[model samples]
Target: MSSKSINISEEAYERLNSWKKSNDESFTDVIIRVLPQKRNLSEILECLEPIDEETAEEMKKAIDDEDSA
Candidate 1:
């Protein structure tokens, strides 16, 4: 496999190293596995936390309705 080099801050490198499973694994593999999944825009709007209590309740209801439909 072809490979390319990239640079990151020491702190960032430390974070990835912390998550790495083994010495046999490359940082590239670690990053791909550790990266956050993309959120659907509507799901983000519905599920963001620190939302007001009433807004949270509304979002819960919307999710329930979606499941029942």
Candidate 2:
């Protein structure tokens, strides 16, 4: 396959490296696996699993704590 080179910060490189599943996995594979696919918001929302009331409350509580801090 044809390839192109791009420059990224050391921090970005480290983050991408950490996402590698194994030494055999390439950075391209890691990026494809971790990055969201191009899709409309409605399509994305439709795939989301509904959370239970307890889980929702806990998420809200965490957000509230973050806001207060």
- Tens-digit per-residue lDDT, 1-69, candidate 2: 888899999999999999999999999999889998899999998999999999999999999999999
| Candidate 2 runs further than 4 Å off | 48-69
The per-prediction tally of clashing pairs is 0, 0
Worst 10 residues of 2 by lDDT: 28-37
lDDT of 1 at 46: 82
lDDT, each prediction: 0.87, 0.96
> Deviation in angstroms for 56 in model 2?
7.3
lDDT of 1 by residue, 1-69 (tens): 888888889998898899989999988789789886798899777875577999989989999999999
Q: Scored by Cα lDDT, where does model 1 land? A: 0.87
